[model samples]
Target: MISNGVSGNKYMDGPDQVVPSDTYISCVPGGHVKLRQTSRGLASEPPISVPGLLKRTAARYPDGPALVTKKADGKWHYTTYKQYQERVRTVAKGFLKLGLERYHSVCILGFNSEEWYLADLGVIHAGGYAAGIYTTNSAEACYHCLESSRANICAVQDKKQLEKILSVRSRLKHLKAIVQWEEPVDTSVPGVYSWAQLMEMGAAEPDTQLDDILKSISVNECCTLVYTSGTVGPPKAVMLSHDNLTWDAFVIGEQVGDVKPTVDKIITFLPLSHVAAQVVDIYTTLSNAVAVYFAKPDALKGSLVETLREVRPTRFLAVPRVWEKMYEKIMAVGAQNSGLKKNIALWAKDKGMKHHLARMNGQNGTTCGFKLARTLVFNKVHETLGLDKCSTFVTAAAPLSADIKKFFLSLDMPIMEAFGMSEASGAHTLSIYPRFRPESSGLILEGTETKFGGAVSPHGPGEIMMRGRHIFMGYLNDEAKTREAIDDEGWLHSGDVGRLDTNNLLYITGRIKELLITAGGENIAPVLIEQQVQAELIHIGYAVLIGDRRKFLSILITLKSKVNNDTGEPLDELDTETAKWVAGLGSKAKTVSEIVNTKDPAVHKAIEEAITRANKHAISNAQKIQKFAVLPKDFSNHTGELGPTLKIKRNVVYEKYKDIIEDLYKE
Candidate 1:
């Protein structure tokens, strides 16, 4: 009953095929056999719940490391699969002892942590829906989720997250108990219990009781509520069932290939609040018994290099911004080099690119020049970036620049880009290995049916509708939004504009809600223009297109600082090389504001050049950005302008800078 939506476009796959109780939009060219074969895995595997998967993995690999966390002393704490299973069971029993009813929502607010994940798994095993909240969410955003979910039990990592809940605790009519993971918590506060106390209480509960509850929990019952990224509006809770989560958890690897247990290393660094991360890190790990390393939220920036050196993960998953920052750092290093080293760096990069191009064309015998270039440049770069053995780098949750993808590919890193939304369970499309289509989202996932709507054509992109086993149950408590998103035909309207090529490669153009129509009737996809600008402009953090119904398009841009973009370090924390690079650009600003807000000629010129490049790709004059303003600060999750996954909240930005946007039209 799940679908992406139907397409009537000429490019529709296999021509209006009648799927039982659903209409398929199109099939990928030559996708029929592979797609059908891959779809069989969903049923081939025995149905299992989250707890059942954990038990299975634990039984198979009792002594193998399941969870890993690093400490301040550069020591790693390992939890074996058996231990993890026991901990999860103990925690689930704690939920029962805490008076959590069946199918009740339990919100877990925090960053990536052992306890955070344990609580989530435990909640579901106890037959409660676990709604994860981003650590960076504002108190109001926190209140919205807590109130709407009607959660009785909430687990927080520290006082900061606890206070956000406490600030609006009065509004949570059903919330009764709060569990704090870290110390220094005033347990004197009514209903505030420490992690130890909860574990103790859980241990006291009968193990038999928890087992019976897990048995009673139906696959179709809601067990998790994932909130949308809320790019265009307020976040809505997407209700997904045990079946919705577990079905893909079991079958996801079929499309991406197997995730070898204990052999492939993976770092669980992304926010667990996001569905993509949950699917990739949690379910994937459990399904294949993959060892997961957890990076402390506060120490992530300082620890990533050390961990990467130590773990040398075979697989890594990240958003586009992470890769972009990595590219920026590499560029910054090159900028600091001079003379022979600089020339060699340039030459090596060129050769690497040439090698990639040749390999992509199915040339196995690369020239000596490419091998030498890789030895001289790409190899060293890979070592420094701790990507030496990272066979695959999976990117999703936002648009990834092809330039970035190519850059990694040149360095012999497989940068596989994927596209999906919260409603899609995890992903709609994931690039197949070895044959990457640049700028495409990849072929449709197995068992997923896709189509285009709203005046779409073979050549023109349209809203992508998908139906598949991967789709979610519905929006939590919001029947109207649910109905609007999923049609009667059971297709999930993706709200994303995309087109499939003859090769069946899916190229995502933009979001339907984000398309800007000019006064002259020219419809433009802002994401396309933004990506173009970002690609052309060095030191650009993000570019927001600003023409909804105006005469012409304009853009608001944020500049990158010398500090590491991933860590969000202060200006004073800039590295020596980066600092010198910034100073060389005639930037004397100390703070974020002084740097971005200052009238620097270099920044202005860079943006102008970027705009010029972006205009080249515009289909019409209206699609081109006529004016641009450089903002002092970038959109972030803390700033309420970015979703948990770092997708821009266009409406929030538009409203926050309404005056600034209006000023652009004045002159």
Candidate 2:
């Protein structure tokens, strides 16, 4: 506990327990591996309360650019730390005036924004629990949260969120009011007020009343109900305490380079509903005093390049989709360049790879060749991607390919892959310097105890079991399910199938519940196979491997492949075979839809060849995909085929294509 803030705790189920803070034995392939957390989350304990953390940061850097947002006309709006503090105070007062009692739940449904920030912190400051609903959730999903959390009030961002709330308004007997950042279109809804009106109403209320409530709040009290995305199943609400959040902020700071108040900057675009984004971008940023730029929801899709160029964040984190597009674009530009430029680029890429390897070997020195490559190659590469200032670029919420990780490291913009879930505030493990394992999810963080246990019968990796302060209290309002998650031994069953390497590095193999057992009695993890497809195949937006209790493995491939898997670049021109194939499909173009319904010769050859290549890595015939069917459209959040983080909604997709799935096994 000297530095890591984790006291010695035994991991075994027996009575005799004397395990140390930085020592735990993990199961590896053939022998036991030792794991430790030498570094601490914070050098010293952080502030106990979320509001107290904000106030201290404000006092230190009152004039610093705190909350930033770009306007409709393209001009940037800055909300200084001082202004941010004042607004949070005012909003807290408003909550008090509206009769929000201690531990009252308030739902904030929206994308990231300044108002959303105020509403979230204000609820905590006023001693209320804040729950966030994803902007991508349907009315039914939103309703479930509203009823489950028993939120007395809702602060929705726009009409879209409001419409969902209204859809189930009659069922929310506990909801007393609704406040909105955007102007309400319909004035007929009772107990609804515009943000301006709410603030004005609170302006007449006494500030001391809210102050007393904030001061009495304990660190162990529930602060937020962070719900899981439920990519493979129904969502569950995780109750994370104030201590849980404040500690994670410090852990994140220690893991990556710390978020500095006047120095660091980041533009947040991930859904506020997700634990990772909320903890890192909002709570962690506020606690560390980092500047946060809130990207407009509409502009999020198209303005990434422009925003990155303008903000040039010192610390950046994104989901896999963003990283994929950036990597593809850079690779494309390098391919399209002329003779001199292309030669220089390729030479630089080679040198950069060596530089990365050197770093991975724990050597800090850059060779003379790498220095020249940096001068000619990497510096420009960073600028083009608006990553010149980025010291840490993290990818989480979904598994990132090892190839993508290496590509950025070659550019000197290392992508730190991390793993976590809402059940545990934000992160449990991360790949960092000196201990970097691009293929694995890195070592366990301070205070977290994870061990593999209860593998599905005798085959495959065991399910991950974790017990730590980073873990949540329990599932909200569902005691039966809560007990099912965290056992009597205090371990929170992760339900993910994984293994710890001899070096303590964690590799997530699959979801225990999502495993597919074939007719041959061979157990297979679909996600692992899906990852292989993504890495090996061209134009694969998503891959759904289906072979549970079936004769052999077959897959559904959603294609919109941007580049050829072999070259990492777009086809110079369609090959004669593919062109002829397209001709047969009655389309004169090479596109996803054009090839989706046709037996286009080139498309067939490409997919078949890709499948054959993927099969080389398979351990058994049951693991290899024997056949695949193409989907016309890519999985999307709007269509409810994907979760907020872009993970496939397995049940929804299966239901949508029941007929197609039936036909696949017909022969």
Candidate 3:
């Protein structure tokens, strides 16, 4: 049974119910399953404020590890819930002593760290709103968000960000204080405060005042102002309330089968500024059943293995790129193996592909022969990748390839493909565990309503729309944009092109705005064609379709990093003779064709076959890639061609390659 604390409700009891010992009742919908003995219960009611939430969580599980940071000496430093609360309170008191007031936004500009989370909570606890700016944001973008949010105080990681703030401080009238978390630098700017000094000041103040300030906060008040990645234009601040955040945490917890913070360790690597990582990773720590771990930014690859070995985390949430990199590594290893091992891997992959095809066609289960083949062959591959311990794997931000999904599931790691946006507070829908549908973004989450708008073809694809409690309050100070996004009926227009199947699973096809209407007036979604072609080949990084309202469709492709010969070599050496090398390679067209045809027949055949496949899926005028160009370098966030979340900036790419695109269309 599930108890509301105020009242006992039978709705909480089910096979999936998490039952924790020590009166820690897991409040998942559909009832109580036994949790681990070490798990402790926090408050039954959701806290109205961030500080209140921390207070109740700390009191319930004082000794449980709340935050874990890897030290420079490679040791994990664990901080208990009580100690974490004390730090937050101390910092909150310090901010009050500095004369911070209610509704004043405090900006946190840094990478993921324990201090980042602590400062965020401290600012909120001191009756101020928390605004997170991405570490990679440019000086102009940073200034825009800070000034728009009306931030009076800023907590920065290092001298670089401090300098940026210092450069623009004179223009920002509300900017009064600057808090530096790292070692002090030679900043000539006024009103700069070191974090150590602030802590000392907090220690000198009375604790009662800090407690009183926390009590004054309400759930309806805005807790955070997270700016969107600005893939389209200038970033917009998504105002999130305490209720909004807590509700997101609640739904995510329910979806993942009620995670216990104390027993389950989660590695935090994604930026804390993003809602997906913050609400899912940090907020889950406050549940007292999960312990959060941090890794060094510079040594991510090496630190991942070290941290995973030490922590053995039960759940992992990551973007598609991480998994894509892992897939590449696995393929590289397979290519290097010899003799019986290589033969066995080839046979297993062939069998796995067949199994995957059957599964996609709605087969109930794998054939007996395929099952035996997998058990004998692919199990080692899974164990070697350190994926044996992963209980719940989820991928978001971009569409996941169906092949990648199948390969992981064959290795006994069923990944849940989720769909979300910054406006939706991170999650819109997730594939249910043990019953996942590959190539689809699963069913809409409970308490969320979805609809379709604009003109739909006979096949039913259209603009995706959503309305839910998890939706953001509005884009901060952008009334026109906010009004345009959310309709009179309260539905948030997602601008994505997709359709729901008969089973009600959502299949995201492409971006509606990116759809091309041919000269013959037929609408074509280029992404569908691009995804099919790209998934079948390993060389393509990104494919952009041209010929919108033109004679025919063509494409421009950015080559994958593995295929780029210039990669990993010194820039000076490459730059000295790049033209000569490119000319030499171009002269050997016959040899290049032979290599492409022989080494990767699949890739060569895919390109030839994709033209036919894409033509069948489109109208006569909108069919096929009439011509194409392969770029030597891949698009990336650092190159300004892709956003932080890895979405391609079409305008940037188009403008940079306009001459090439124009040449492709010429007679």
lDDT (CA) per prediction: 0.74, 0.74, 0.68
Error of 2 at 389 (Å): 0.7
lDDT of 1 at 72: 68
lDDT of 3 by residue, 546-584 (tens): 878788888876545322232221111122122232234
lDDT of candidate 3 at residue 594, scale 0 to 100: 35
Per-prediction TM-score: 0.88, 0.87, 0.81
What's the TM for model 1?
A: 0.88
Q: Which parts of model 2 have CA positions greater than 4 angstroms off?
A: 1-47, 184-189, 231-234, 454-461, 561-587, 590-593
1-667 per-residue lDDT for model 1 (tens digits): 2333422122312111211213222111111110111335454444555766787889999988888888768788899999998999899888888878765778999888889889999998887789998887888888877777778899999998899889988888888899998887799999999999999999887788776666555444456888876654678988775555766766667677856777877887788999889988888788888888886574334557666777778788888877877887787777779999988877777777777677666788775588788788887888887778777778988888887887776666768887887787787788866557668887677666888876533223577888765677666656577777877677788878888887666998877778888778777788878888888866667789988778888999875544445645333333454346456667664445655456666546756877998799888777888898867566666566776667788888899889889989995
Is candidate 2 or 3 superior in TM-score? Answer: 2
**Model 3: residues with Cα > 4 Å off, grouped in runs:** 1-48, 187-189, 299-310, 346-379, 454-461, 562-621
Q: Which stretch of 10 consecutive residues in model 3 shows the poorest summed lDDT?
A: 28-37
Clashes in predicted model 2? 1
In candidate 2, what residue range of length 10 has the lowest lDDT sum? 25-34
Give every collision pair in model 2.
539-561
Q: Write the per-residue lDDT of candidate 2 for residues 219-310, one digit (tens) a residue.
A: 54567888887653577777776666877777777777545667798989888888999889887787777899876574335567777888
